[model samples]
Target: MQAEIGLIGLGTMGSNLALNIAEKGHDIAVFNRTTAKTGAFFEAAGALRSKIIPCTTLEEFVGAIRPPRPIILMINAGEPVDDQIEALKPLLSHDDILIDGGNANFHDTIRRNLLLDGTGLNFIGMGVSGGEVGARHGPSIMVGGAQASYKRVEQVLLDISAKYEGQACCAWLGENGAGHFVKTIHNGIEYADMQMIAEIYGIMRDGLGMQAKEMAPVFAGWNEGRLNSYLIEITAAVLDTEDAETGKPIVDIILDRAGQKGTGRWSAIEAQQLGIPATGIEAAVAARSLSARKDEREAAEKAYGALGETLKRDAGPLEDLELALLAGKIAAYAQGFAVMSGASGDYKWDLPLPEIARIWRAGCIIRSQFLSTIAEAFEGAEKESNLLLVPAFVEMMSEAQAGLRRVVARAATAGLPVPALSSALSYFDMYRQGRGTANLIQGQRDYFGAHSFERIDRPGAFHGPWAMNAG
Candidate 1:
């Protein structure tokens, strides 16, 4: 009996995904650059060995699968993916499917799709989220490719996808790059969420003189309520873990330098290029960049002083921090979706915003009860670009904005860095204003760059000489 599908790359994600497929009763043929990894996988497979056909080379991997074959590339993004596809291109027949399940830049996906346009071999840029454990169990699958190609493998994809309430958290977002684009923006929002949480943690530690032990229960409590999420739950667990040697909180001993694999930066960059304000996401990216300059920070601390050492802790406002977090979260999601909405129109992807929200409600890292509200908000709407304008979210924002304002004020006064939270509040205020200070910017642009500005009173573009620079 031939395997129904094939996978190339037996890394953690790929191997687990193959196991999942095999467990679902679908025979899978898998290949890897290093045959040793494949050997190890087969050994671990044990009873499942009969289900997974191990292949040492691309030709063998292709030969093992059935016709109209769907092969997933869980390999690294960029040139490596191209290399694999090029090697597999000669072997794959017409109507065969090639799926890229990695954190690829959406632009690259579009380019690759364009490159494979006339080849007859289909290309799918798919996003798989939920980390290592999620792979072994099930992961949220976001697919973007030709609709016909997607139709061919829909059932198999659905079978392997994470299910919530008996429905798969997988769907075809659009053709060419939509899935990766959505995933990119998803990571951006994740960065904002994590940064805001860290800012709150900062408030607890330095601002309120609370230790990890004292603060862990607070996160655990939050997880039981509106903030219930995998990230928050794991954060509490991370804080709860103590080092084996000194018994100090593991997080305290860990370096503050956070690592990123570029998706968050891409999200911020795309938003900026689109002329959309994703300040919350942008702030998070900037914070990580700043954190990376550990030496400079140490020097600055030595030369000047630590903000925590200098600033006085006024009110802890633990409950207010929760409210502020919720507000920031709403704003972050609003911005992320706004970017997606803009891209959908610009690229004519016709992305289903509501469906995207639905899939994200579970199986992804950013999964939260809040996503349900987001889905509901999008579903009930007449289709708008921004989530904040949705009636449900509008009311929620109105009620919770005060908390955001108060928290930002407290953090500012305490000389604490709350860039993500501050940016969210600023974005909210900027979004609500009928008239903003942008007129001065327009005037300056026209004065310096000869870029004409449109007058609100009339409809024509106008330029400012400004009294010939008072010469």
Candidate 2:
């Protein structure tokens, strides 16, 4: 019998995803450029080996799949993806679907769709999250393609996806690049979340003089409360781990520099292009870039002295820290959703905010109990409503904002850097302000560049007095 679906690339993620498909009782045709790796993958399948057809050539792989085939390319993003698609195009029949399961830039996805427009091939920009383990068992699958094309493979996707309360964490979000765009924004929020958490860790370490061993339980406790999520749970485990070689805390021994594969930056860029402010994400990206300047940082520290020694302050209650994190999280998520809303309008994708939240509640790295609340909030909210304006979150922010205020104030006084946290707090403050200080900015713009400013007292744009004095 012909295989139900086909997969190319036998790298770690690709191999695991193929096994996952096979484990779901659907026969899968798998091919890799390296034929030996394909044999190894089939051998490693063990009990599920019978369900996977290992093919050495693209022709064999395409032939093994049934008509109107759905072939997933789990290879590297960019040129490799384009090259692979080109190789498979002639082999695929009319309506044969090609899915790019990589962290591709959304613009590339759109361009690829246009490139394949008249080729009788269908394309899907699918964003699969949860890493290697999730790929092997279950992943949060975000698909962007034609509705009819998605309908053909929806069952297999749902079967292989993670579940929350028996509902699959998989959906066809929109046409073209919506899935990848959402995934990019997801990483951007992830960066903010992680940076805020790390800032808290810095406070505990520098401000409170608490060691990693002492901080693990604190994180463990938070996991049982509102901050509960996969990231928090893993943070505790990571804190508790000791370096087998040096016997020091693993995190301490690890380099402070973090690496980026471009998704976070892409999210921030897209948000800016869409005229939405993702301050927390921008701060996190900036933080990572700054962290990479180790030599400059070291030199600056030598010249200016360490920040922790500049001021001393009593640490606030741990409850304040927890609440502060929650508040910051709300701001980051609110900004992320706002960016998506803006993109939906600009791209005319009509992205479903509620379904996006629902799928993120499981399988994805950012999975949290908080996402369930977000999903519910979006259900009844207007399409353009900010998440902070949702009644439930309004109450939440009302309570949590005070804690955030205290934390930012304390961090500032102590000369501790909490860029993401501070940015989130500032974003919240700016968002809620009825009268902002931007009037001065408008005046400055008008004085220098003849830019007009709108007045609350008048309906039309008005020029500043400086315009009358211009030479």
Best by the TM-score measure:
2
Cα TM-score per model: 0.96, 0.97
Reference-based lDDT, residue 47, model 1 = 93
Please give the lDDT score for candidate 1: 0.89
- Residue-by-residue lDDT tens digits, candidate 2, 1-471: 799999999998999999999999999999999999999999988999889999998999999999989999999999999999989988889999999999999999999989998999999999999899889999999999888889999999999999999999999999999999999999999999999999989888888777899999999999998889988999999999999999999989888898998999999999899889999999999999999999999999899889754324344547788999999999999999999999999999999999999999888988987898898888873633798988888999999999999888988998899999999999998999999999999989989998989998869888988787986
lDDT of 1 by residue, 20-82 (tens): 999988999999999999989999998999999998888888999999899999998899999
RMSD versus native structure for model 2? 1.6
Candidate 1 TM-score, true structure as reference: 0.96
